[model samples]
Target: MPFMEFVNFYLMPGIVLGSIYALGAVGITLVFGILRFAHLAHGDLATLGAFAALGVVTIFGVSPWVALPVAMVACAFMAIGIDKLFYDYLSERPKIIVVMSSLGIALMLRAVVQVVWGVDTETYTRGIVRPDDYWGIRIRDREIYTIIAMFLIVGVLWAFLQKTKWGKAMRAMSDNPDLALLSGVDNRKITMLTWGIVGVLCAASGFFLGINTELKPLMGWTMLLPMFAAAILGGVGRVEGAVIGGLIVGIAEETSVLFIPGEYKAAMAFAILLLILLVRPTGLLKGKVL
Candidate 1:
C-alpha cells in the first residue's frame, strides 16, 4: 500500500481511536491511583454517557457538540451517586469486594442502557459523512475534534493537578491517604471531585466514540478490554503513561488487521496487556505496581 493510504486508513483512525481510549484510560488510572480499586463499571458508565448525549440531542434538538457538556454533567452526578450508594459502604472492606461490586454495577448500567435506548445502533446524525482530503491524507472534522478535545481535556486536567489546591490535595491523597488526612485534606470532597472528573472524561470518550463511529448498547462494553489494556500498559497510576499506552494499543490494533484477520484485532489488546504485565509490571513510566 502507498504511504498516504496507510496513513489515512490505519494511522489516522488509530490516532482518533487512541484519543478516545486515552480519555477512558486516564479516568481508569485516576481511580486506580486514588480510589485504589479497579472500576469494572467504567465502560458501562461511558455507555450511559453516550446515551445521555443522545438523549440531549434527541430531546433538546441540539447539535451533538452542544449536548456534550450536558451529558458530562449528567454523568458526573450519576458517578457520584453510584459512589455514594454502592462503593462508599464498601470502602473499609477488601478491594476485591469493591471490584466485584463494580462488575455488578456494570451489568446494571448496561441493562439500563438497553432498556432506555433499546438494542438498536444509533448515530449522532443521520446520513454518511465523507472524509475531507488534506494533501494526500483524508480525515473527518469529527476525527480532528476528537483528537483536539482529548488533548484539551487532558491538558486542563494536568494543569489542575499541578497548580490548584484541590488538585494537589487529590494527588496527596493518592500518594498517602493517611498523611493527607493528617494534613487536613478533606478526603470525601476529594473523592467526589475525582469521580466528577472521571465522569466527565468518560462522557467525553463515549461521545467521541459515538460521533466517530456508531453508538450501540454494547459499544462501550466492547471497548472495555482495550481501555483496560491501555491503562495497564501505560502504568496504573501515570496519566501520561496512559495516553502513550492508548496510542500504542490503538495503532497496534489497527495495524494488526494488515497481518492478521480483522476479526482477531480485539485480541491485540489482550496480547499487549499480557505482555506488559509480564515484562514490566511497573509500566512505561514506572507507576505504582498492582
Candidate 2:
C-alpha cells in the first residue's frame, strides 16, 4: 500500500475513533473520580443523550449543531434527576452496591430506550455520511469536526479544573471527600455538577459515535469496556489520562489489524489495560487513586 493510502486508511480513522473514545473516557473517569462508583449507567446515559438529540432533531428539523446542545441540556437534567432518585438514596451504602445499582439503572434505561425507539437503528440525517477531504485526509466532514470538537472540549475541561474555583472544589472532593466535606464543599451539589458535566460529555460522545456509525440501543454499552480501558490506561480520575489513554487505545487497536483480525481489535484494549495494570495500576498519568 502507498504511504499516503496507509495514512488515509489507518491514521485518520484511528485519530477520529480515538477522539470519540477520549470523550467517552473522560466522562467515565470523572464519574469514577468524583462520585466514587463505576457508574455502569454511564453508557446508557450516552445512549440516552443520543436519543435525546435525535428527538430534538426530529421535532425541530434542525441541524445537528443546534440539536446537540438542546439534547445535552435535556440529558444533563435527566442525569441530575437520576442522581436525585437513585444514587442519592444509596449514597451511604457500600460502593460496590452502588455500582450494582448503576448496572440496574443501565438495564432499565436500555429497556426504556427500546420501548421508546424500538430495537431499530436510527440516524439524524439521511445523507449524513458525506465523504470529504482535508489537506490529504480521506475522511468524512463529521470525522474532522468530531476530532476538533473533542480537542476543544477536553481543553476547556482542563482549563476549568485547573483554573476555576468549582474545578478546584471538584478536585478537592476527588482527592479526599472527607476533607472536602470538612472544608465546606457541598458534596451533593458537587455530585450534581459532576453528573451534569458527564451528561453533556456523554451526549456529545454518543452523537459523534452514532453519526460516525449507526445508532443502536446497545452501541453505547458495547463501547463501555473500551472506554473503561482507556480510562484505566490513562489513569482513572485523571482527565488528561483519559485523553492520552484514548489516543493510545485507538492507535493500538486500529494498527493491530496489521497482524490480528479486525474482529479481535477490541481485545487489544483489554490487553493494553492488563499490561498497564501490571506495570502501574495508577495509570500512565499517575492520577489519584479511588
Instruction: List RMSD in Å for every model shown.
Output: 0.8, 1.4
lDDT of each: 0.93, 0.87
Candidate of highest TM-score: 1
Q: Positional deviation of 49 in candidate 2, in angstroms? A: 0.8
Off by over 4 Å in 1: none
TM-score of 1: 0.99
| Residues 1-290, model 1: lDDT tens digits | 99988999999999999999999999999999899999989999999999999999999999999999999999999999999999999999999999999999999999999999899999999988899999988999999999999999999999999899999998898888999999999989999999999999999999999999999988888888999899988988788888998888899999999999999999999999999999998888888775
TM-score of each: 0.99, 0.96
**Model 2: runs farther than 4 Å from truth?**
128-130
How badly does each model clash, as a count of residue pairs? 0, 0
Score residue 2 of candidate 1 by CA lDDT: 91
Q: Tell me how far the alpha carbon of residue 133 in candidate 2 is from the true structure, in angstroms, after superposition.
A: 2.8
For lDDT, the strongest prediction is: 1
Residue pairs whose backbone atoms clash in candidate 2: none
